[model samples]
Target: MTKTIKTVSFAAAAILVVIICTFLIIRQTHENVLSKETVVKKVEASYEGKVTKATQSKDKKTYDITLENPKGTYFVKADAISADILSMNRVKAVNPSAMTEKEAEHLALERVPGTVKKQTRQSQVATYTIQKEDGKTYEVKVDMQAKTVLSADQISSKDQQKTPITKKEAKTIAERKTGGTADDADLEESEGTLIFEVDVDLPDNKEATVKINAYTGKVANIVYED
Candidate 1:
């Protein structure tokens, strides 16, 4: 009887140990599965927003961002985010909801030489255009001041058409203009006027250029760094 009782007790203890180990293993497995599932879900959710357009400055120093949403539009600055996120490849994948419109605008302006010229709010989103020192222009859209750029496009003038100019005609025109180059002169798309782009190279390797209507040839713009 004593031997039987001892045997029964040992079996009961062995069963309890097995039960505990099984419970722990199952719990750990459930936890591992949940963790992986959470990560996958997060990754999938990160790509919720769509990017419309992106442009970098001519110097490759600044980035312009634009995004479109069902409500309206948004903007972001590439430098405000990590450099890793600034690449054209990554910019295409940014989630605009993660940042504010103001934040995005600041990020873009910080990387470029300009200030926000105007901000217009319409319904669900806001639009901002930046005017730099040298006639460079940038337009951005954002929902709030969080500074995320929903969509960004650089402003540049369309190329004008070229008109025929004889060498004597070019030289005569060049002679009348101060600080002008015949090599820089070209014809306007309107064909009624001539266009000349004045190149003033700055010490920083940044050029302060201007486009003039060469026939009427009035200074169309004082700055032309598009």
Candidate 2:
């Protein structure tokens, strides 16, 4: 009887040890799990909001954040570092949640139809940077919610606008006025208006710019390089 009691006690001690080891392993795993609540708390510290809403990407990549106010909502870029954007740089006003990426790409291609160099989300807009065959780069903004291209502009200069006068016409007019041939012609924005600007090289080795009104199709201004 004494031997049996001793054997039973030894078996109980071994079982208890196994149970404690398993519990420790499970606790470690739980501690290692990524917590959304922790990330939200971190963001709330920076943005000064209650973080009323929070979401993770489908692949468990990044988090999308929303405050109590509708306008106070923001998005987090999905990745390892996980950065949230309160405001996007150089982005225009547009509707978010307009369309899918594929739809935006298709719309951009239909509108610009050039080399699709880059695609990114700016603020809430689907922004695409395209390079043309003529070596000109343009930025196209698509409002996914509105399902339309909001604006297209040359990346370098907001100083240009669409003109009714064609490039060929502008060049011809510039050459006739300056007695020179066109080096190049482009529609550019000057001041608050759009103008057709033609660069001409004269026989006197002078370079001149002829500006034509985009709407009126008349000579607007000219500047000669000194």
lDDT by residue (66-134, candidate 2, tens digit) is: 553334444443231344444322222333555888898889888887887667786658988777788
Per-structure clash totals for the candidates: 38, 5
Specify the highest-lDDT model's number.
2
Query: Which residue runs of candidate 2 sit more than 4 Å off their true CA positions?
Result: 1-163
The TM-scores, one per candidate, come to 0.23, 0.28
Report the lDDT tens digits of candidate 1 across residue range 12-39: 9999999999999867644443232333
Candidate 2 Cα lDDT to native:
0.71
Q: What is the lDDT of candidate 1?
A: 0.52
